[model samples]
Target: MTSHRKSLARVLAVGLAILSTGLLVAAQPGWAAPAIPAAQPVAVSAELTTADADAWLDGVLPALLEREEIPGAAVSIVRDGRVLTRRGFGLADTGISGNQPRPVDPERTIFRVGSVSKTVVATAVMQLVQRGQVDLDRPVTDYVNIELPTRFRTPITLRHLLTHTAGFEEVYANMILPAGTPVPALRETVTAAPPDQIYEPGTTPAYSNYSYALAAYVVESVTGREAAEYLQDEVLRAAGMATASFAQPLPERLNADLAQVYPSRHQQPIPFELVGPWPPGSLSASAADMAAFLLAQLNTGGSALLNQQTLALMHSPALGEDRLGGLAAGHRMALGLFEEDRNGRRILGHSGDLIHSHAALQLYPDDATGIFIAVNGSGARADSATVLRRAVLDGFADRYFPAAGPGPSPVGTAADHAQAVAGIYGLSRTPQSTFMRAYSMLASVQISADDAGTLTIPLLTDAGGTPVRLAEVEPWVWQDSEGHHRVAVRVDEAGAVGAIGVSPALVLLPKPAWQVMAAPVVAGSLGVLLFALLAWPVRAIIGWRLKAPLDLPRRDMRLRRITLTAAAVIAVGVTLWAGAVMQMSGGFSAQPGLIRGAQAATALGALGLVPAVWRAMRASRQAHKSRAVLATLVALAFLGFGAVALAGGLLLPDITY
Candidate 1:
């Protein structure tokens, strides 16, 4: 769930983690940096030039694409409202042996821009605000046709949606569907089943595609037009992005030019991804079209799509700026963008990912420079696209605009602060109301503090793929010891860490020690249950062969059989559940029967505690020490497994994912 493929792939990832905790704890070899020599820092240039940008991209991109095994990508750099360089690399479609491959064309080949589509939607909402067609602070219910359910009285606002502060728990169901799936109206998707508002509006920043779709629905309701049409006519056309679209299954004209995304260069292309929430991540656009959008955002040559005041509002920090205390200095969420400052440059952008494709669009507002890059394949490692994009963005900033000096020094109270913040943390974007919560528990990250007070988070790494060492530079604020990434902890009144801000788009909520240990406990129970169940058959066979089964009472014997049955059922149940997760090709809803069967088996196993405990007591009273010990062990294992099932929503009435 921590990575970009946080849907079905993420469930498989967490299963691997739970089933093999040692491997996950040891290291992540997949994220290792490619064996490329580090480039020396270059002197600052007098002015941005097309020739220099072209030369730099030529030297960097081809090597990155080959090393990562990414099939193809398109990148465009915009400076002072003009495209400095736009280029494509590798084959867009890796043709069979009989046919020649089609090379990527920045001008014609379209790519799924993923979550970068959020920025486009945000721009559309701002245009409405500028024209007095929508209200930023008013409740979204005022514009939409649905009643958004929330526990808190605070109304969710358009501002909250733009900044990802609407607090909607992550929704993976129906987000991606089979290619030929019928496209639903924006209103139908948002109103069908609105996710519960898990946090108070404007309080916490949880990246939510659902919230973005709701915002788009508001756009539709206000304009009285379909979201795709409204966006195309007003936002895309205004920015001169003629080839960009928010339509699903894209128009036939654009579909012919769409790049085929692959799991990797060695694998076949995946099915055409039908994005349900089209406004959030369904935008298909060419690199040249994106370059034009950047130029319009920069308002170069007076071709601005938004007025100056509205544009500034869109780029300014709308959440987690000062509310988080010192952590506020770490990462900030600007309206529709992430405030990803680097090399002393104020960078604002959004990254988008759709299983096989990845993209990023970062704007250097201070220098009037923006670069958009999109990759067509995930490469060998599922995260290769992510790794490659980070390399380009960070490398570009360092080469063109280096930091002035070293990072801040540790504060006097660094040791105390580090000790307080060290613990297991879970992602805030997790689903709390479904069976998927079990996976979330398995995906918790442990942040450890050494004797010297430096905190280590193995999940977060540097550009070189090394675990970043962090030291508190202020109360509750930590800076990377050797890099630019910063971390900040939010504490409650009791002085315990409540949440952690790792980046503008990521927040990690603290997990109780018991909750953190649940996965391990369940795994241990499964092992014990297997051992007890296997031995039960062996003991029975031995007794039958010897014809010596006259020692125990009928009730005791019956209790023993029932207890063993529970153990066997639990083992089968757990195996089935794990297998379902690893083999999931669709949303959890797609395999309801398998999931429900496993749930029923486990629930029946939970009822074994009555007989299991009674059998243990009976054996103890009879002075049968060995039998008592084994029976007690089995009972404890059942108790542990049952506790986990109830806590993880595995037995919930509704079988929602």
Candidate 2:
């Protein structure tokens, strides 16, 4: 696949791996009364019992697994602080050579529950808060001995860290390393290349693994114990998650029981993955063990893990309601979880992705129920994991907790409001000052509007992979037809759409027309340059075969050579950069030297613009207007390409992404 397509696939995988609706919003001016009648949601009847859950899961999961070509999955369901059922489906490890396939075991097979580790780490920090060893409002710098290169004046606190509002740029460097790669100290790993902080603390939510790593470092600083050690003692042990561990290169006893992960069902198992930000997303545990952790969070089992009052504080909305505006109607950030309300019930959950293994954990606190599902394979399609994850969550909710749904109908001004907000949005979780900024462009989301005030975002989809269609229900607030997901927007003082909130932990900021068109401009310019340069070889062969000596002035000949050489260099540089990005297993940390070399080559090519411009002017003075136009076209194409590179920070010395 082309580098552009590959980068986009990776973005979609991560975006969907987390929940689809994950952004932020602020209040703006209110609008008028209803235009369209609201549609009511459908309700179904099903009791929450072990037998019912098993029957429901059997009817739903097996069909999904077979259709999606997923190898295996493990699930745990809990109610009233007790495990209702633990089930394993499909194979843990497909046959290798002549060996027999191993069936997944809910009690024995361990799966890496990626970012769910963030919830556990947040719990540890809260425990420290209860003991007076840590304060949620204190600046993180007070505990970790590292100063952040922040863009805003507000100090980053543990609350900001837990809620993903610290504003650190999204980074993927060293996120996953080879199994035997030596792990670094939390301090060193986090401090090595700190992401630039682009938003004020507590003002915007930008999902960040780096922020969680910093929070974990604070835990280490206060306790003088490795984060894993502290979590093992205070969190895991207390929750009765005996099989869980944050250790990379899992202990021999547990490693044997680890289910092999796969890119797809028909593919061979991938090698063991070592997570870099261990505290944020590196916990391996069985389905039964995960159930115990969920029960503790529900305040049923593992009550010693956290006190009731403290736990309540942790789960309550951490962001101020007034600051949230229309966003209050949508998702909101709690200390360690996303307040993803569904079917009128207040739900909190987090999704995790380890590339091969995808997991979703949801808590229906009011109903005293929680469900955990983790699959060993991401199906063949790019969005297979996303489809499966949403299906299980939505299916389970609809079966047992269905509710009548219909919010306020579409406002009279919905059409105009949708038009104003429809545009390409840049994710706040992107590198703002690095060459990786170029890659971030591929992750932009486009929101479209219809005359009826409905909106469509291709990135956010339902369980069936159809883009979730939305209608403006109120001023600055849009929700799915069934009210499963709510999206909110913020308008600037100038009355332009400023930001969008789809998830509690994420925000999408507006991208102006120029920024949105930059990639295509650069790509089109490359095509022009390549087309013009081809004339050089074509003319040489044509003239040689015809035996016609077509002579040109010495100055014109020199200019032609110079322009063609520049085009050649630009093409080679871009090709090299694309190859490097496609081959990178990690992020920018891979192939740094080669990427820098390409940057240098492009820099040298940009210098050709001066002579090309001079040549165009000189040619225009002569009798041949056609030659002048040709020269001018080449010069303009080169200029366009160079301009995008400079504007994107592609030629900048910084390579950290």
Question: Against the true structure, whose lDDT is highest?
Answer: 2
What's model 1's lDDT at 623? 74
Q: Model 2 scores what on Cα lDDT? A: 0.77
TM-score of each: 0.91, 0.92
Off by over 4 Å in 1: 1-8, 16-47, 97-99, 320-326, 540-552, 583-589
lDDT digits (tens) for residues 370-408 of candidate 2: 999988888888667667878898888878877665666
- lDDT, each prediction: 0.76, 0.77
Q: Rate residue 356 of model 2 by lDDT.
A: 75
Per candidate, the number of residue pairs that clash is 1, 9
Model 1 worst lDDT window (10 residues) = 22-31
Q: What lDDT score is found at residue 101 in candidate 1?
A: 81
Model 1 Cα lDDT, one tens digit per residue, 27-94 = 12232111111134323543468887788888988999899998899999999867898999987888
